[model samples]
Target chain A: MQAKRVTFPNKVLPYLLLAPQLAVTAVFFLWPAGEALLGALYAEDAFGLSRQFVGLENFAALARDPAYLEAVGVTFLFSGAVAGLSLALGLLLALAAEKAGRLAGLYRTLLIWPYAVAPAVAAILFWFMFDPNVGVAARALRGLGVTWNHFLDGRQALLLVVLAAAWKQVSYNLLFFYAGLRAIPRPLIEAAALDGAGPVRRFTAIVFPLLAPTTVFLVVVNVTYAFFDTFGIIHATTGGGPGRATTTLVYKVFKDGFEGLDLGSSSAQSVVLLAIVAALTVLQFRHIERKVQY
Target chain B: MARRDGMVERDGALTLAAHGVLILGVAVMVLPVYLAFVASTHPGADFLGGRIGVLPGPDGPANYAALVGLGAPPPGVPPIGPMLWNSFVMALGIAVGKIAISLLSAFAVSYFRFPFRVTAFWLIFITLMLPVEVRILPTYKVVADLALLNTPGGLILPLIASATATFLFRQVFMTIPDEMTEAARMDGAGPMRFFWHILLPLSRTNIAALFVILFIYGWNQYLWPLMVTTEASHATIVTSIQRLAATANQEAPVWHLVMGTAILALLPPVAVILAMQRLFVDGLTETEK
Candidate 1:
């Protein structure tokens, strides 16, 4: 809502500047979103020839559909696992890098480059490593007396996708966690040390609590990444699994609409996903504002 | 003296522990890539018959050359040379396009007032959340209906309307002293003149940083390109690599070339990140903030 006190008086230039962004948003984002909302209200014949106005029918059908429910459950499980795993691993890596002293920069660079790898590529790399026949890691695991076949087993397939997704995300979380660590005043840690507290004690009493804001922010981001961005991993590696085991909600939307040609249900799912993203964005914005005020 | 010695010993032990953990972390981070690179160097079908050799092979040059079409085309796989070009074009377009539009829009929102000004900002802001994956079907329908399918504009335009870039630029512009603008106006400089001369140069670092992030993002895109292109000629390295993997599974499983393509798919973005490491980190943290 704020603008420059000594602002330009040219009323026309601002509109011109806003036009391109507005046009793209309207055509690409807003219009499609509107169509999704509208399409969700109607069910079309599979042949795409006829349609009937069926208010809330798609929603009801989604509710009744066991596969949809499974997808939702799987999505939540996948996201929660990703968020938790990435955050914990990231925090650990960040803490280690902070303590790494002369090697910190090298460690940081090495650790963060994975953020640049494509999710699909990351999945492929992992798939190769875990390939039942030739995968060295899989062979290693088998040597330890465990069977590893993602193509045949649904849980293994889900786990594979989760790891692939979480692996790509760890770098993002690590960067944030490391930044948060750096932002913490060193004097607090020194003071704790002077009070005879150990490193773990200092972290628990002083550092971890101060990281609350960063943790919250990363939680939303990591969840969003897992929920939406990992579509590449699922699409490339598992294709929603040996039996839909790895099909997150976003994946289901693509599968249903594009592959299944069930436009109505897919649009309804998109609406649901949109609502979720909006809610997360609102939460993130509120937190950001609060952080700024702080 | 004894207490000092004890404190020194404890610090040394802690630092050593830290180094140990970091080394392990780095290994985990680098292991897959290292393995993939190793796998790419092996002769064809090596993954099928034996434990994948952990070390590099003699065929690295031939495999990579084959991947790029310098050698014979790997059987059952398309050359990644043009796919990489498509990816490069898309990435550059999205990055440049997003920055150009976002800079203008952020300038307008920050420096001027107009009807629907807040509404426009909010509208663009909403797009930060509505990524293409969520609205795939309808968005695809929009693209198809417009007959923009398989076109570079189709791949680039829809994605360039970014909230993060707009917000980043707006934040940077707000930090510029109001006096700068006032002084420019006092000199009878027009709005375009002020923006071109003052704001553009001042925000160079922000733009550069954002360019790095957006380029990586655009290059790594999979789902949208997969949906839009549908033509092999338009395929990005990322999507094509996946297709190669799928095909590999269905038939002979061209492990060597597929691994090579995977390596190629990741090379540009990783190179970009490493080359602009500081800016990438700054851009990421700042934009997220």
Candidate 2:
């Protein structure tokens, strides 16, 4: 909220400066959000003839809907797996890179560029490797006696999407973890080292504890990422499934709205997503404030 | 000296372990793309039920030539050229547009005190909570109502209002000493003049960093583009890859061309990130913070 001490003393100029952003936000963001809130309360009849005001009916239906419940479960599982896998790998790589000496820069460069790869593109890359027929990884798996057809197996489909999603995310998490690691004071690690603690012990005792804020921040980020951003990955690779196995909440919203034409239900789902995102954004900002204090 | 030598030996062993882990990590990171690249170089028939080789094949030039020049071998899949151009334009538009609006808004909020300034800031800040995914139907409706569907404006305009960039600029502006503004005023440098001459140069690094991040964001957009552009002409490379892959999935499975498209789709953003890595990192951390 801090502003410059000196005033510009030009009210008209300030409004002019703010106009474009405000106009865009109003049109693209605020209006649509308002419509979503209103639309969630009304049910449109078949053939788009008339709409009925259905108070909380859409939300009630979602709560009881088995498919929606399944999506909720899938989302949690997918997000948890992606976050856990990516965070652990990111931390491990960051720790190793810290000790890599001259090779650290090269390793960082190689590891981080994947951050720029689109989630959908990342899904494609992994899909090629994990395709049921003629896939190298699938062949290797089949050779090991594990059936790896994501097309038929629901769990395998989920796993494939998870891998694709997590693979793309690891680089982002690594960059943050590496920056967090670099910010940790060196002497603290050296002091722990002088006390005869090995690298593993030092990491568990000192380094890991200090990286807690970063880890927490990344957990929220990674979860939010897996929730919202991985829509592309799921859409491109599995198309939400071997049945509805890979159907996430966001994907379901898209399916129900665009494909199913369940406008009321989709709007209700949008409201739900909006609430979830608002909560996450608030949590993120609070953590950012805490991080600043640290 | 003997104890020091022993410590040195231990450190060397640890460093070796570190190198081992980093090498494995790098391999895991690069393997998929390498495999994809290798797959792209092979003849389409090679993937018709056999183990895929790890090495690049002789068909690299032919596959890429067909992909880049003739589009996918499939009947409906559009050429890579137009899709790539669409992606480039959309990405550049989003990045430049977001930065332009955000820079001005942040400047207004930080440098001037006017009525409804707080209201304006909050309005923009609220956008952080309402991602396009959340309000997909209605946002699509708005764009459609505006008749922006399948146009560059449809792709870029809806996405250009950025709260993160605005906040980042505000954060940057806060660090600028008040004296700079005071001195500018004394020299009669108007608000716009001061912004162009002083603030713009001072924030050049932030802008570049932001541009890198936003360009990637814009290029990688999937759902928005998928919803907005039903036309192949306006289809971005990222969204088009999905369509191509879906088509291949149903038919004879042209793995070579699909992989080729994937490589082309990812190449520009990856190159930008690698080329301006430091800026990207700084932009990422600063914006998130």
Candidate 3:
């Protein structure tokens, strides 16, 4: 909130400067959010002609709905897999690149381009590779006597989505992890090396511990990504199919609201998603504040 | 000398292992796209049965030409050419719009004191909590009411108020020494003039860096464009690929054309990130921090 010690002495100009951003935010963001909050409390008839005040009934119904509960579970599983897979791969790759010395830059460039691929595009890339009929990866799996149809198998579909989501995310995680690795003081590793520690030992005792903050931050970020951003991934690849196995909360909100036209339930889900994001944003900022202090 | 030689001998193996890991890592990252590119070169019939080829086929130019000119198997799907243009316009609009508004707001917040300034800042800050996906329906209704649906303005405006970019500019502005402001004031450089000359020039790198990140963010946007722009004329390449894939799922899979479309859809953003590698890295690490 701090301002310059010397000031620009124009009240009207400052307001004018802030107007466009404020106007867009008010109309597109605040108003819609306000409507979602209010709509969560009311229900409309199937004809969209009559409305009745429901007073927490919608939220209560979501709490009892088996499908909603299943979605919550699925979201946790999906995000956990995404975060864990990407973080581990990122760290491993970062560590290797650090030691690869001269080849590091080339590897970084080659590896990081996937960060530019959209989640939906990433899904299709993998979807093509895993196509049941003629995909190279699917063919390889079949050669190994493993059935690999993401179309009919719920677990296979979930795995496909997870791989797609994690593949796109690994580049992001690697950048952070590589940066974190570079930030570690080199002499600390040299001193440890002088004391006769192996590579794995040195990583566990020094490199991994120093990178903990970066890892923590990426966990929150990757989870939020898997939750919200992968809506495109799920939509494009599976459409939450194989009997809703790949449907996360965000996908369900889209399905119920836009597709099914269950405004009340969708709005209730929106409120829930909003609360989750707010909490995650707060956690991210707090972590950032702590990182700033360090 | 003997101990150093022994150390070198041990380190040599470790370094080789490191190179091994990095090669594998890069291969894992790049293979899917490579496979996709190879598939795009083959005729669609090649993927009808049997295993897909690992190498590029003879049909690359024809497949790409057809996609560029005529689009894919889905009868009504927009051509890759127009969708790419729409994607470009939407991405450029979002990036430029966000940067312009954010710079102005950050300049106001950082350089001036006004009533409700804190309130204005928080109002923008609250947007970080409500992504478009969370408030999909009501936001859709607002656009529909405005009759902005299926328009470029509809695609760009609703998404352009960026709290992250605003905060990034504010952070950049805070680092400017107060004496610079005082010097500009003493020279009678009015606020806007000083902003145009001094502040703007000084923040060029930051601006470029932010542009890289925001450009990618805008280009990669899927769910918003998918929901807002129903008409194929306004459809972005990203969403169009999804539509194409969906149709391919139902009918004979047009793997060649679909892969070609996917490659085209991803190329611009990937090219941006690679070309602006340094700025992209700085923008990402700094903004995230």
Worst 10 residues of 3 chain A by lDDT: A95-104
Give the per-residue lDDT digits (tens) of candidate 2, residues B200-287.
Answer: 9999999999999999999999999999999888889999888788777778658888898999999999999999989998889888
- Compute the lDDT for candidate 1: 0.90
lDDT of 1 by residue, B60-90 (tens): 9999988888968777888788999999999
lDDT of each: 0.90, 0.90, 0.90
User: Where in model 3 is the C-alpha error above 4 Å?
Assistant: B1-10, B70-77
lDDT of 3 by residue, B128-245 (tens): 9999999999999999999999998999999999899899999989899999999999998899999999999999999999999888999999999999988878899998887788
True-contact fraction in model 1 equals: 0.80
* Candidate 3 residue-wise lDDT at B151: 92
TM-score of each: 0.97, 0.97, 0.97
Poorest stretch of ten by lDDT in candidate 1 chain A:
A185-194
